[model samples]
Target: MGYLRLLRQRPILVLWSSAALSVLGDRLYGLAIMWVVYEATGSAVWMGIAAVVESLPYILIGTFGRGLIARFSSFGALGWLDAGRAVVACAVPLLWSPGQGGITVLLVLVLLLGTLGVLFDPNLGGLVPDLVRPDRVREVTALLDLTNRIAVIAGPGCVGLILMVVSEVQLFAIDGVTFIVSAAAMWWLRAHTHRVARAAAPGAVTAPARRAEPVAAWPVLRRHPDVAVAVGLHGIGFFVAAVSAVGLPTLLAVRLGQGAAGYGLALSAVGAGALAGNLLIGNLRAGRWLTVYCSAWTVTGLALIGYSTAPTLPVVLGVGFAAGLAAPAAAVTLRTKLAGFVPAQRLRLITVDQTVIRTAGTVGMLTLPVAVDAAPATTFAGAGLLLIAAAATAAATGRRVTAAAIMSSREPAGSQTS
Candidate 1:
């Protein structure tokens, strides 16, 4: 289904709008908070600490709090969480001061918001499947991905525009307002969904069976080896891609003698590429999703290597665009497959996948910056090679798993000794 038609459905429209606004708010808050921290402390070290703190919640929640996500996988709970985040975000400007004590409070608030985010994300993922037809899940996923890309491109620009007229501290208040609007929309959606469920004929729709015992994502992953391979490759890709967070700016400064304008252009290229890629994949009807997923990463790896070799700004932009183009295919493919799982298992696995990716990214961010600065081209090439190798491993493993399944199916009923 086309995005417009699908979005015309009130539930999908509300959900998409809420998500878009939330993401934009997140982007604005991230930039604003970082600016505030640096301005108040004038320390790069403190900024780095704040970055690490922001990522810690994802690892912590995804590891130990998966059950929390499962338990609160409802619109009402999600709405409240957004509302809570709003309060936390707005507190930053009001509570902060100019000394160490103020920075400590700011860090705590950042952690609180991040924790709420870690819970909010997987629950929202689980909720999406219930709102769309089975076959149209991929389309909805693409649409959501598109929202993220637009936010990536536009959010910082929006912040820049806002800063021209208002103080950086006020951005937090604006972000809080966005969250409040999102919460209101979600509450309305919850009421609408409940009404539709009640109005449906008794036997018209069957609900997913609830499991008495919560299933761990690892066991389910073992049962689906192909998904396991895709997820593993995804983690590696994330780890390698983290280089860009530091590497891109370094590259533009060292090699091209360009600063903020060059960096912004490169980022814009990436966002535009991702937007196009999502649209392309969403419209296609394809099989062998595992192959497509691996291929996307392979292309991404190639783009990274290309970035290393590029000696000009234009080349960097082109390579960044290519890398962005391939990203959504990998993400959307994995999400579409996960959506096919039983609802209970699906939520856990999504959480696990997110944890793995976040953990890998955090590690990469900590470890790769020095190498990127020392030898930017060599480091990019090395990371690209590792990414390609990871993609190859996933593809080969998927093929073996597929062959084994086919051979087992071909065996006679009596020949199968359980």
Candidate 2:
């Protein structure tokens, strides 16, 4: 009911619609390109290269390009980026050939799309708080997360049906159309709303003069230690998640003697759990965000540990479902907390968060495979234990920070009478 109420508002409706379309399109594009690349090359190595090339931009841009991203954290700029992606998506089929030259061109296009994505993703996170009433930020965030979960669940199936009737290349064209539609919706929002502009305007009181200067995220994060802790823990969580991503299938094969079908069921369970979590969070009023965030990670860690000991497919699915359920609570709360910062610092902080997550995931992907191969169950349990420890540390640190701040506030201003 709450999600339905939020969806009725025109701006929220438009924004949600665009997000749904764009995210689904992204899924289509990603699967299509990977399929096309592997088909053309018949090499897993090329597929791996393509995946790395696509993910590398997030790390690069998030680490070094925060200021540039801040400057373009506007609806119009975001719309243009979507438009650019549409062109790039459409060009893949038109320009690609069946040789190494074509594969090279496809990788280049993928890289370009990824770069644009890095620019667009954090800015969108920063934009959501500007688009809605402050009380509804969490709800909108949940809605967005829900959209992504739905896309993850349905995108592949949709692609499967499409591939039965059309070539993989045509999926890019459909993805292109979705981007164009999203761009149009964004531009409409730009024409209708002034909150973001007013908040960012130089003369506005909320937009401090200091905001014009490029503020580094580190100093800003240092000033807000809780957010810093959340960001750190989020990275650790992603690292653990990457380990599970690689280990889960292997576990299913060796332990349960299952293959793709089991893996698919596990994924669907997670998606279903995530969808339920989003709906629950979206309907409820906001609570202590940091506590919810930490607790979610703790539960996630427990779920990972559960995965290691799951003896049957049903048990594995249950563990997967629990992990998925916790993910959205952690993610939505973290974003809701990040929304509390000023626009300039908010975008930069989000960029830093994204950078940390992407970097951790990349490292996990590269370094965890051998460990996973040697000991899948141990890897799962170990990663789970590490995540739980990180969550506890973050919670303890947050408590100390809160206590110190309170004590400082209570102290006399001029107590040194001597």
Candidate 3:
């Protein structure tokens, strides 16, 4: 009853529901675009170029967009972003034909979407602390992660069914509708909620203004070495994830002698496992977070090694599941630690921190191709060993601020003591 009661609260419910729908739409849109591109162009090179264009905004805008986000009302910014994306998604199908420079048009649209997404992302991260009670941040973060995992697991199957009955253009129409719904939900949440003072008196003292000189992110991170280390550990986890994502199909096709079905199953297993992991992490108290964080990576590293050597589809699936289970602990713990370590005043910097983490995944993915020429087993094993080292590094750094200490500093006002 209590959990359901919490879920019924308008802001939380609307934000979470909208996020889930948005993620599902993104998955569907991505699949449709890739399929359409390949079908129309009949060239893998074009697909690669599309992928690079899609990724450029994160790399470019993520570095420069934080200041712009910090200047606006995060909730309003997020709503406008959703609205803008909805417009773009709707316009995409109207502007394209198979042979008339469709690839160029797709690339431009993808770039625009990525730019909007980059601008939206940090503001969204900045909004979380304001939206929920201090103690609920970790749980909310984990829940968000769970929604994404669910989308990843179910999106392909949903796409398969949709494609059986509708054109890709029609499926994109559905995607546009999802964004419109998400934008509506965001607007509703904004209308119903205040960033601060849900229950304060009309004449309560307002907080002091931020400094004229913006707080430098690098200095703040330098002062909190633990935060930096935790971020790096998070990045390492992401790196492993990126590598596996790129490498799994190769392993299935070349080593295990399976095809698309096998790859899909393996991916499904990973997503399911990640969902389970996030559920477990969400319910866990702070006292156990560090232990879980360290152990999860250790297990994930071992799972990667296991996956590398798996001789059959079942074994590979099992290994993928195990790795998935371990993945969320590192992510959730690190994020929780961040919420504990970073002061409310500096919380906007979280976007920058997260940008680095995402970049780490890109770095891992880029490096993976270099090793693709090596045996699959050898490449995976090496990646596993690097993650194991990352686990050890996280544990070593974690001793500086125990989870108990983090729990004690959960207050929203001055949580930066970590």
The best candidate in terms of TM-score: 1
Regions of candidate 2 where Cα sits further than 4 Å from its true position: 194-214, 405-418
lDDT of candidate 2 over 1-418, digit per residue (tens): 8788988989899999989988888888878887899999998678778878888899998888767777667777789999999999999889989999999999999999899989888888887797788888888888888888898689778878888997988889899999999889878877766555575675765432122234698877666778888999999998878777778889889888989999999999999898888887778865677788889999999998998899999998998888888888998899888888888877888889998998888788778878999999899899999999999999989877866766766889977645
Provide the lDDT at 341 for model 2. Answer: 81
lDDT for 29 in candidate 3 is 84
Q: Which candidate do you rate higher for TM-score, 1 or 3?
A: 1
Model 2 RMSD vs true structure: 3.5
Per model, how many backbone clashes are there?
0, 0, 0
Choose 2 or 3, whichever is better by lDDT.
2
RMSD of each: 2.7, 3.5, 5.2
Runs in model 1 with CA error above 4 Å? 202-213, 405-418
Q: How many Å off is the CA of 28 in candidate 2?
A: 1.0
> Candidate 1, which ten residues in sequence have the lowest lDDT sum?
205-214
Residue-wise C-alpha lDDT for candidate 3, range 1-418, written one tens digit per residue = 2234446767878888988888889888888787878888898667667776777778766677555556543465567888888888887889877874977787798888888877776556656655677878887778777778788788888888988998886666788888888778877766565434444546666553342223467766655656666666777877767667677788778887888889989988888889887777888775655566778888988988898889889888898888888878877776666666444334545666667766876676666756855677788888889988988877777666544446555657755754
Candidate 1 residue-wise lDDT at 312: 92
Cα TM-score of candidate 3: 0.86
